[model samples]
Target: MKLPLSRRARSAPLPGIVGAARLDIRTKNLLKRLRPGDIAIINHLDLDRVSAEALVEAGVVAVVNAAPSISGRYPNLGPSILVEAGIPLVDQVGMEVFARVAEGDTVRLDGGVLYRGEEPIAAGVVQTAESVARATQEARAGLSTQLEAFAANTMEYLRRDRNLWLDGVGFPDLATDLEGRHVLIVVRGYQYREDLQALRPYIREYRPVLIGVDGGADALLEARYRPDIILGDMDSVSDMALRSGAELIVHTDREGRAPGAERLERLGLRAQVVVAAGTSEDVAMLLADAKGAQLIVAVGVPQSLEEFLDRRRSGMASTFLTRLRVGAKLVDAKGVSRLYHPPRPQVWPSVLLVVAGLVAFCAAVAATPGGSGLLESVSAVWNDLLDWIRDVVT
Candidate 1:
């Protein structure tokens, strides 16, 4: 169940519960015991929009997210969905705060006293969900007001700058259309070799267009598979991969040039440099999605905020927007790999085969008793030599 945006300043009543709910369940399931006007304590205020349906129906008043779910990166599903469902959401509370105040803690949100639990502990409220909801609303409203200008500027950035979005977009949405064409996308680092091996069958079967994103080219080459198109900032990719016989799409920045682009030109290879302000992976995904590729498979790509943090990138908002725009046509290779249950040779079959080989060897030994005796003599002689050597060495 999902929830709608709910506000603390509601004319009517609140949900049944009035405390933190770190547990994520259907609003109906949650509302079975939880009443309207309850405060929800979640790990992070990011819930699937579909999941929010229940909360809105139940009329939850406030919510608190433990981690930084949306520091303005991807859209905050929890707070946004909750507030849209008439609920408020808070962010960045200490981990101990939830434990300090259990299901029935008396907490203050939106200037209202909510008795979360009768015997719950005390959790000092830093920022209330009510305040977060108001802030989120204002920020969204401000963005909406500037949407026209932002979109216009984004388009201008695309045109003047070699946006990653346009790289390899000549055949936008033409994956299946490129039927019988072998299109290879490259990804370097670990698991990509396995990825190529996994995709080899598909590559051989479908033979669609191939585009490698940076080091992805190196991975392809390692697997003895040549790439037809390579796209990325070219930082992680090898010089050999950059020089590989493929149509290179150098991902540039807003200033219209980057070292990668220059390197491609220096190699006498004129790349379709895309000057976009986003991650190379995002640009590659958007390009493939727009190119109408029958399928887009991402390998070893950062999928979460933690992963993004590992890379220390601050362009998640741009990347998230790109993903939102083209998420439908994309397929993450990792997710597909999770579902792979390749048929393993049955233990019985392997055992039978081993037994049969052993039996055949024994039969051969029996059939050639003289030869078997020679083999035994040779083994004895070798053992004797080893024994003599061991004594002498000692």
Candidate 2:
């Protein structure tokens, strides 16, 4: 028997694909409007894995890039992921394609050639697994230079954010007291969803102060957990997550300008504003450490050198310095999941077991000769009780 094709297989482009064109030079911005079955026209160079995953999740039928999908820049894996998902990726079709095709216009992809109606608009390379692999291998040759630049950026970051490390720079008082308690800080990165799944038992047992960093709040909501605290620029989190009664803290730079604060004001929600340098995740860790959290568990925090670079951060100095400040108390989500064996089953299960045993005993008693008379007496009492309830209703 032939089974139905999977969603990926069904959505996969045929020899010729026709779909509504959706163009965005900014891949992140474009994702907001992109719908499944729409063709995405992006100008992303060296497309990072996170953006690629977002495109896949958006369910775009195909991708048309004005820029090279992989420019031999340190083995970026975005293109390969798209191709592997059976989404056709046509790249380097020149910037003119943006001008030729209007948004919402019907566009066609005949292999690497893009067409609007009968007229062929542009042509470019169609990426494949083999080609992506070759490009990745070539990109690795440039890693040494990237490493040197990263080191210089880290040193510069340390110099600029010295006050953060020394004075705990601007930690705010929170209603949720974190002292001697575990704190879970989540960022929407990597296998954050998977990490959250692995942490179900931990969250249930410790009831840690749950903190969501921007879009990470939505991640928590998706996992069916309401955040205790939501922090960041507030751009990516949903209004539902914001209104879920989680305390909001808007992340700001040393200048104290919070972009997220204005958004909340328009929504009629109040939030505490925090000023600091570095990414919001850095701010979150420092805040948790200063608030006297005994243990800080991070989910989807960027840990590797490649991950930070993939995020296109100029320096990880703040991250490095923040980690140092929170040393001994910090633990990765993976470590928490693996090292912390789930606590023994709790009171509810024992209560359930006792209830089941009682049910069995009652049934056995009802089947016995002497207990039959007792059950009959109880049934007559129950009928009389129902009659009384009926009389009261009348």
Candidate 3:
């Protein structure tokens, strides 16, 4: 069972087969060269669509997830990938069980008994193997179609928005009148984690101006980076981020009054209300460029066409204009995490907010009837929102 059969005879010992070697060592080796169409043993059910697509394309027939049985943490992209690819997938197998079958072990299947080296670990839901093959062809076709549409949208955005590329514009031009020597832009969402991780190392070396656009403020705070400024409507940003050391810029419409700007003033966080036409991210970039920022690092800025489609943005024209406004000072945070090593945050402000929330909840519950009801709803909603925030940050 070591691998493909040796020339001598049927008497050679395989690497992870019975009597050949210990289980852990064998399993590790098996993992090193794992290919598609093999039984997959996993640790969790949750997987993103990207990873799932990769596994399916690789042709892995099944996966053994070791995660909690019912977390529903994410879609088991792997299972769906297997199903669509016409491969078979099963879940929840501990590592101890999977080690029993090695690269060349013999195993039983529905239609026939087959060598482990040749057959996948599980079977698809469809009764016939021929049906599985057909499904795989269809799934691949569908994936291609989806990807094509994704590509078309992305190109359309780039075409509409000219700022992603600048001929030679650089630092000095992308700043406001007040002028920040350093500037950081935060765009909140799943991409924020990737962006922050990329920019974390750079923050220490170059302390730029910090500006959070709504949820981006939460992102900045999560990374332990103190924001010097925040831009956007007040929605999605935490009160703590607003109150934290940054100045606020409330994005408004052409009418010259923003409800969000009014709220910032009430909190004693003075703000400039800018009436703009695009998203908060676009405005933040535009304002930084206008403000004369020497260097601007934008985190979680969307680039792909599929991403724009998902966001349902009208086009890339606005962002393009903003980019041209900022010029060459802008650097994408999407790739930053790969090369940066950021410092650990000394502040536990986000964690403390949880404690403060609980205390507030207790006080509210102990107060009037109306207060208790209000606290209950707020607590649940706040927790759900916090969970979403946690997802974006980590």
Which candidate has the top score in lDDT? 2
Poorest 10 consecutive residues of model 2 by lDDT? 308-317
Residue pairs of candidate 2 with colliding backbone atoms: none
Q: What C-alpha lDDT does candidate 2 achieve relative to the native structure?
A: 0.87
lDDT of 2 by residue, 347-380 (tens): 9989999999999988999888899889889899
Displacement of residue 82 (Cα, Å) in model 3 is 17
Clashes of 2: 0
Output the lDDT of residue 388, model 3.
100
TM-score for each predicted model, relative to the true structure: 0.42, 0.80, 0.42
Candidate 2: residue 254 lDDT (0-100) = 65
Best by TM-score: 2
The TM-score, computed over Cα atoms with residue i paired to residue i, of candidate 3 is 0.42
lDDT of 1: 0.57
Task: State the lDDT at 267 in candidate 2.
Answer: 90
Question: Over all chains combined, what TM-score does candidate 2 have?
Answer: 0.80
Name the runs in model 1 displaced over 4 angstroms. 1-184, 338-394
